[model samples]
Target chain A: MILGRVGRALVVSELVERLRDRWVLIITALFVLLASGISLYGRSAADAQSTVTAPSIVTLSTFLVPLVALVLGHDAIVGERERNTLGLLLSLPVRRGEVLLAKYIGRALALCLAVGVGLGVAAMVLEPGHRAALLALIPPTLLLGAAFLSIGTAISALTRHRATAASLVVVLWFLLVFFYDLGILAALVATDGALSQDTVAWLVTLNPAGLYRTGMLVSLVGTEALSQMGLAVALPSTALKAALWAAWIIGPLLVGAAALHRRQAVTG
Target chain B: MKVQLCDIQVRFGHLLALGGVSLDLRAGAVTVLVGPNGAGKSTLMGVLLGLVRPDSGHVMVDGRPHQGLPRMEREKLGYLPEAVAFADNLSGRQVMRFFTRARGLSRSRADAVLSRVGLAQAAGRAVRGYSRGMRQRLGLGVAILSEPALLVLDEPTGGLDQQGLTLLWEILSEWREAGRTVLLSTHDLALIERRADHICVLHDGLVQAQGSPDQLRRDVGLPVQISVTIDDDAAVGALVAQLQRGGLADVQIATDIDGRHRHLVMETAPDDLLQVLRIVDGAPSSVRDLRVAEPGLDDVYERLLEVTR
Candidate 1:
């Protein structure tokens, strides 16, 4: 339904709006500077051992991209509400699901563009061999961003106030991106072997940020930490991780659609 | 198209927005819902648009019942929201083009409607730069872009200046002449009392009253006023006697400060209007000037509110 004519209209509208928005511009600029700076710095210490330093760049993206994606998309619905345009929009032939999908597409595209251009520009500074690693970061980073955007849009739909949505997404960003793995480790320690390694790894899989970290470090052949925790054996192929990411994206989208379904009509 | 709202009731928490409200919108007529703030005017329009689901009700368009207007029916429906807004960065032309695509209208219809609303000169300017009236005009442009059979506008005149209001009124009148059904809500009593063909006075989620403007004015049964100026002081008593003799009571007579020219005022019931006029007409030699003041829709609405209180 979101690929229909009306859906195309809303998608193009959101794309144009996001492109022209000042906040989006600022975030994209910040991402570019950070990406190029991190890549340049990662090159400084990586003269040996795989010789590419993709880990540092992946780590940077694992933290930065999701944060940026959430900040960009956390207002998808309530922002329209505050602008007093939500009623006019919902009154159109478009459904709430179409609007949520449009916002996700528009924001995901913007976030992906930032990831590409930022890393691509940084790739120019790297040796020809290492540039491939920087380029590889783009796909997974975009997947990570796409999933966070869905979560952000879900948060946007679940709340009525713009400030509340914004604050909630930030709190969630911290919980997922920064504290998720640490909390899992803490849980394992506190449980005194009660939580199995498979159970612990499954908990990590639930967090997009943790799953992305594990997938990147594993594919880069950096299993020093995971081997110790039995996570190296527990986690399998990139394809499985990729499917999980797809779930992360689709699950939040369905949640957002459901929230919008339950959304009440506003009064003047 | 003819529309019927069958006992529409909406509740927000414990507060009932519409307490079993039913209304009929006849085809080719301007039916306005008039009420104060929180009187559920917008909510009622929301029900008609199929945006808000009533607690228990059915909306029928052209005799077909619907939970919400079907896609085919929604295509014929257009709406202009209160406090209309758009993406601030797009030019007015671009905004109209976007709506044109959403409504699945021809691409050419966008520019045509832009110029029709007189936004042609400023069409290339971003919406942020447009004044409230211009933005409202753009909203108007979007609503009529589809030439919808049923056009609903909520508080369309809230922030408009005189020119914007004139444009709105002109379009509404043209739509009425062309037999398009229009529904709107407003609180500007004086401005709308004349423009609406049929008015529904809504208060506290109830359809307190509904009818033609004249019918409502008569329904309220407010006083019909007659004012008279006497050519001579001696003729004042004769005219008052004639009016009293003609089954008219409550004649209030007052003389000028010079105690020369006399003025006579009378307040009578709706049924006595013709009799009051006839008596004043029969005393033409003594009555130098006569004026009749029929109760306006505003007065009728005000009287209804008083009774409701």
Candidate 2:
């Protein structure tokens, strides 16, 4: 319980630091403006037969959330280390694991407030009648943000330089969010639709972004959308998607925390 | 509380940082670790802070093994690392509050410490605006916030001005007087000579010598040098010849630029200082001026380092 109290204090301190960071303010403002602008534009375009809903917001977040999370979390460990403050922090009574956990949770909380409040405001303005849909979109979006935060934290732990961590997070983002589905599609085309359904299922579930996208679509649109494409039977169930998301959040974080715990604080 | 390091060894890649280094840091005294750069002074402090794990040894804090000390017990030890940097975005007050809260101390304690370090006026200003000495003072404030039993600092005076240095000395003296253990690493022999109760000379990753300043000079057999200035060069030459004939092994006579004033310099053991003085008193030329310079921490440090090398 004392350790927990210390962890909470660390989280509070981290949040205070982040709140004072101009870059965090800029990022939050950008997200709110972008999301609200998109929602308003979609509302006016309803007469043109185009509509935006919870799934549209989820699609937007698939790209936006990971970008924000990566930017916020990539420097969590290595930045402190490079700035020479990690030694001072660790010199206190808190354990290394507490620091890592508190850092992740604190950064995640900041991301959640930004994305949740930003999207919540946008959803209220655009979909005042669809309260159920708006509520359903929040969890998956936050989960997706957590996935990337954890991944970025892992990158931070593995690298000792902020530049290296930033670069690796970018590469990882491109691979998981942008290139993953495209690569799967290219594979299907290259194989002339001969790729096994099980192989396709595994590949989609393995990518956190892909898993989030499919889970959101299946939850909002139901299995009928998959069935029409003859892909429903091959896709993972909603439970499996949730499990994969949980795994994405936990796996890298545990590994990163372990690495950080074993690391020697850099001394002059 | 006392800290005992036992056969500590640390290696970084192909380099050996510390090898079989052992030290006893007594309670209620100021222990200064002095060494050249890369002599593993920082590494040893890091070990004591639990920031660096030894390769094959252990540290004991107040007779308890370092690993056996719980987080609550570790809280009683404070550390100020060399050139420590805080978040530039946070104000000095905010930074102190963060650390105080992290140590589970209240916000009032943070304010108390800020005032103690004379940072209360600057507490509202962001740390990015702080000068080097101000930042070092803030670091000291954070280290002392918990009233730690063992306070460890590495190069704490690196950026301090004369006033800041004086303030630091006063704080250290207060801590020592409070029956707390103060361990610090410094290259400033002048400062150490005045404040250190125990001095450890480290070189090549090993302890060269360890003792009080006086004990060190005595053990090293460094002598007090007595310089006598005579009214005339001829008298100085005569005195040098007489002292050389008198079996004074270390003696030199040098005429000033005008050739009118000459200085006779002699190095004698502490016990023979009076004998050398009597010899000078009985010299042919009456001494115009005389001065005695004892071997200080600087001399002892250099001699010990040289001998170990």
Q: Could you tell me which residue pairs clash in candidate 1?
A: none
Model 1, docking class: medium
Model 2 spans > 4 angstroms off: A1-3, A46-53, A130-132, A189-192, A227-231, B252-260, B268-271, B284-286
The prediction achieving the highest DockQ against the true structure is 2
- lDDT (tens digit, per residue) of candidate 1 on B1-309: 788988999998888999988888877788999999999998888887767878898899889888656666777887898888787888998888888888888878998999888899999999999888888999988889889888899888877888888888988888888888899998877788778989999999999999999888878999888889886766777778877786675899887898767888899898988887877777748677788888877788888999999
Per-residue lDDT value at B124 in model 2: 97
TM-score of each: 0.92, 0.92
**lDDT scores in order:** 0.82, 0.82
Question: How big is the positional error of residue B118 in model 2, measured in Å on the Cα after superposition?
Answer: 1.9
Question: Which one wins on TM-score?
Answer: 2
- Tens-digit per-residue lDDT, B95-208, candidate 2: 898888788899999999999898999999999999999999999998898999988888999888887888889888998899999999998787668899999888878889
lDDT of 1 at A224: 74
- lDDT per residue, candidate 2, A18-102, as tens digits? 8888988888888778777777776775543123556667777888889888878898899888877787788777888888889
